[model samples]
Target: MPLEEIQHWTWVFGRAQQMMLDYSLREIEKARTNDPETPMSGFAAAGGAMLKAQTDFWSDSLKLWQRFLMPEEAPSEARALSEEIGRRADRDKRFSAPAWRDSPLFDLVRQSYLLVSDHLLKGVDAIDGLDARQKERIRFATRGFVDAMSPSNFPLSNPVVIEKTLETRGENLLKGLDHLLSDLGRGQLTHTDSGAFEVGRNVAVTPGKVIKRTPLYELIHYQPTTPQLMRTPLVIFPPWINRYYILDLNPEKSFIRWAVSQGLSVFIVSWKSADAGMKDVTWDDYILRGQIDAIDTVRDLLGVDAVHAIGYCVAGTTLAATLALLAARGEADKVRSATFFTAQVDFADAGELTLFVDDDQLSVIDALANDGFLDGRYMAATFNLLRSRDLIWNYVQNNYLLGQDYAPFDLLYWNGDTTNLPALWHRSYLTDLYRDNKLVQPGALSVDGTPIDLSLVKTPAYIQAGREDHIAPLQSVWKLTEHFAGPMRFLLAGSGHIAGVVNPPTSGKYQYWSHEGTAATLSEFLEKAVETKGSWWPDWIRWIEALDDTRVAARAARMPGKGRLKALEDAPGSYVRAR
Candidate 1:
């Protein structure tokens, strides 16, 4: 702590304490004046009651602190002692009064004290909050703090306490502080091994021969072991929200490999991570320019009139938009059929995420977009908060108190991968699609003066929903089936978002259920279908294979010439990098 920072913090702490004292005294006076004869059961408790509680909490906190910072003492002994002191304190009634039951002065003063306490505590540089097992481990590790006079972890770890200290400064102050902590945590977790990187690395392990496309991005083409190939090739459109390699992860889990093995030519789109140059790239540009370019490149190389397309998550939205845009321009003949993996086109019921995307929030986002791109850390933090009890709290307990090294879990590592959204596009997306619910309704959204109509899309569609997807709730994604006029099949998977999509047959525990005869919401489908244990991927492949044409296509006389690489050595491409 620098002298300047210490001084600033002290000043804030003093001011907050003063506010708390003033509020407490004022409330006390009000109580006396309002009902002079009333028994002071609540607000008339002894002054030392608050003091005693504070003292007790501090005593326990100090003991815990010593266990961590002290030398020459065994951690187990220290922890046991801390627990004993906590038990003793817990037995005392004086310190156990609920906030509502406490005297007005005590309640107000304590809360004010909390404002100062929080800042002082966070200044210690420790993560706050812990899961059950983690809290148990901390208690065990800091037993020595059981009877210490000085507190360890005495102060609240929440950042809100500091914000209360700076409330007069402005709400923006709190927002900025929150953004700082969020960015710090995100940067640490997403240092490098993000989901995007993992996907790229794992794709290289597919069973068939792999040929490098753009070395910079590790974009490659795969040839199946089987000689027979389907008439029309398959091109996968992955959500830019994550890397494209999720479809081609490990050998057993590889959807792309499975497709190729089923005798189909498969092409996967590997997106490039945008930089300052891509700041102005609009949603329309992605579909019209990016997707169209990839399709043209594929067609020119393969000489295929139409390609089977699969889109997942946000990419499904892009694919939907591309189909709509293409249809409006009479280019629908290029698409044979489409499959959506938990993609949402209608945001009418976008799950718990909707609560945070009102008009007021969009305005703030609009201002943030002035820099052209919205920081990926901001989005990552928001998602982490959604599961705060699990992600944030668990990390704090494991890493800080126990001094344990973070164990690597591929799912969690991938979860930590954060990506940025262009501010303009993010703002427009939230306001137009989520807040307004426009795409499904006619004349709601106009791209380049042309309206987007979902009913106009007549491509055969297969839409699958996971039972538990926090990002795109099953109900919202299922709404797409209602809007599409083409023949559509709806399937339900047993797991959550990423797990459900990356379903490998070997997992063996997965179950798929469907309504069969009726076309309704996912909930309705699950209600009528039988539960069977098996991977949805194999089932999906089977359905897709049945729909595919059987004629085998020999190797073409000409193949798509390799494109020039931006970097001869891999720098950073879309799949191998984080947002």
Candidate 2:
């Protein structure tokens, strides 16, 4: 509020303003003018939606006022409100400040906001003139704005911020502003204690050697832990969108480390954070040179006919495509068995993410990626919108209002660390797979001059999905069963995308449900599946072993940096270290 403080902000804004690109400014202007990218539905549908929201909001306000005027004994609304007060989500740490519960003024404010938010959020459903994808965009944009304007986000309205400011005699506000300035300088929000963790030293610390390096990715071969090694090596293709260290966050949460310990030679792909040069790298290159080559290298290095493969998220989706490509080329024998983690093959039931690649917004995405590669921050920001209340606003309140530092969270660190996607790869992925739903359509997609057909992918498969996964909806993941002719087993894990896959048995967190018999739908699968508490890693290990539990005497590692597969570097290679 002081002149000096205002002067500091002006200087900061001046510097930031000078650096703004023309395209960025154009985007801002487009947004201001209600751009065509995210068009408002027809006047009738939108008008009706606003009317409904307004009516409900005012009606709820009247009910609240009536309750205050007439002192009634346990009214239904009062009882419901009391029950909601005891409910867990609102009672979580974000709103744990005493004033939120104790202060009548703040309680009414929170309740009013919730009532309006609920109506506004539900306004975009099944609009007459809009398609499913367009409706999703409106819904997402509405939620973003609503979440941004929450009482908890602003210092004056937020109880925790007010309390902190009083407790620290306004010093918290100073620190909060400083944190904001620092984040602005960094060009991204700080989600974790960045200084606390380094990739190879702590997080991706599993002992492995970079056996193969390429333009797209570096393949790491984890040292075998068990005395006897599985004859068929296990190769994992993690989503190129994020670094592979997510599977190796730490020993306890490390999926790679555990797989290695279970008498399996684990080879994982660490994808390069692509630069502008890779803008022309098509999906074919990613399929053939990136994932296929990694598996082939593992086979060549280990002298194996086939390797057991696992794919996570988009990598899982790509694996489905790769399996189809392999099948089309009559080389399906290369991958012994396939396991998918929250991989969506069907876009028909694809959830919120479809909002980004809808017809209108696609042009905007294309324009943004005109520089060859789409900056990952754009995708990261969109993902954050999925759970903005928790992922974005809560962090904003904590980091900027309560004057708290973003805490050290391994998962959040990985979430923030994103990678650029080549323009062709990004466009083709969004258009063919996501928008057009081609993977399920046999002969619809061609990778490396082969018309890929998922039905021909007869490799025995294990598909696991997260019940709460927002990115890859469980239903879409379940749809993989319909197209693949292979014997398939589907499992549902308790958490979202990351935790569900990185789950370790040692931690004893999250339950996984498995159905022995093949079920047609996700509902039928979940209904019959027995819920087993703890990680699904053991179940997967047992399943993968049963395919062919042939064990060979474990081979010792060659001298450091001396062998034919001469280790490029230990464990995580230079590719992952690319910013």
Candidate 3:
């Protein structure tokens, strides 16, 4: 059955069952009333509560409609629109409702949309003291309803779609159907034109070799582009939820290539795409075999006591936790310095991602563990919902409504490259870090039998947060400074989660903000910050260089198998190529 059909039937059956239960409870209550000594049973009380809630809903709805009907008491938004329509014969061309002023029928349709949208938002707000998750659910549902009702979604109502149909003589609609069928066959929504780019040849094309491999990861040591080099090597820990190639997408935007050109030894931890066999993998396994092992391999290859470590997004949080674990084991000095790129260690205000992460929602996700690993498609869908208008509906219109092909873009290609998450690790992340907010709480979480304490991390830190990031909000990322005992610097980047971090100096695209001193709050830091032109990459490089004094004439680049660990494959390693 189609999902929608199943849902409709489910609702029908649920309502029937509730009605039957209510009838039974009322009969039981009547019998109990005959015996005055008998008290109210649990079932009767539950039915009474349900009845009261239903009554309240109808009462409130009636009051709302009554107020809406009264022109004197009608919402200001509705009144303003009515006044505007009377003044102007033509509607704003920029809006989807251009036909609103064309006829009374169209005007009524537009006004009804506005009035319902206003009421929906006001109604959600009027609910007394809703918890975060409850409020988020309401907002998410409202967005879905509002998007569905958009005039542009319908062929007859949408002026632009109608004009396109006329221009193409209905060819566009046919093409759109084909696009929709293709995506349906793939069992996932198409986000990018996958054919426009190839992995090793164009995307993660930086010249590099995989020197070491674990069941969980492949560590790639990028070739140096300069003759002279800094003594301390830089190892990057990218989020395992997606492929590591995000940092190395294309020549111009590649962070790995830029660091290599700057005479710094670069190594990246390329995580294996998880599957059924990897279902049993634990969070500690990621810390141990994934990151700690990569650190050990890099240190051994470079023959250095410590190296500069960098983590992006989720990897940054894991990296901080790993440092804490190392400190607990008296091995804190192994990392010379730490840099976090749009990663958050604290989850108190983890942004929109946290909305779908409460106990009930997590239970539903946990139920998906029957497949061993959570499907990457599921993760992608959740993220798309965060910015549905752009990520979901935009594609829907192009691929289905308008029959347009996806544009070829490196960043979009990277976005479409999805990876699965091991069930165990996914569950732990949801329950511990997100649900409990345990990382910042000492002894709340343990890795390898040692309790995590973020304050134990004494290594100098550099943290970057994207101003427009919805995944890891800037405020949440800024909380890292409070937990770290070491000297910390925070950078506010201009773009979002992916673009902000991938920004290269050559693009001359976005500006970054840097404060002279760490402030008690993120707001204070932003207020006192000095805006600087260009990418934040140069500032990061300067910070890393300042921490390390030993610079010598660079030696020849280390090839795979030449290092302590033997080379298994070429760049863009086999794990990343996994289906």
Native RMSD of candidate 3 (Å): 8.5
Candidate 2 residue lDDT tens string, 113-176: 6766776776666345677666777888898898888888898888778879999999888988
Candidate 1 residue lDDT tens string, 1-579:
354553454355445544655555555555555566544434444332443343334443443444333423637755665445444433433223342123332332333333234333332223234454444434432332221211211113223223333554544434434544654765643322243445446443553222233311233445545666777777777776565666765677777777777777776666655445557767776676566656665565666788788888887887887778778879887888888998999997787566568667677777765667776656766676555535554444234322333454555655555555666666777777777888888767766667878889998888888888888888888898888888888888887787888877777767877655875666677678777687777766666677766666445411212323122223123344545
Candidate 3 lDDT over 1-579, as tens digits, reads: 354553454355435544655665565666446554435454344445444444344333333333324446657654665655434424433233444455444444454455455556655655545686787778778877876776656777655566679999999899988888998898778877899899998899998788877789888988777767888888999999989999999999999999988888889999988889998999899898888888888888778899899999999989999999999999998899999999988898888788788778888888876878988878888888888777877777667777787888888788778898999899899888987899999989999888989988899999999999989999899999999998998999998999889899999998999997759898899789999988999999999889995875555434446656667778988988887
| TM-score for each predicted model, relative to the true structure | 0.64, 0.88, 0.83
How much does candidate 2 score in TM-score? Answer: 0.88
Candidate lDDT scores, in order, read: 0.59, 0.79, 0.79
Q: Once superposed on the true structure, which residue ranges of model 1 sit more than 4 Å away at CA? A: 1-204, 207-220, 363-370, 521-523, 557-575
Error of 3 at 447 (Å): 1.1
For model 1 the local lDDT of residue 409 reads 56
Question: Model 3 clash pairs?
Answer: 228-554
Q: Model 3: how far is 456 from its true place, Å?
A: 1.0
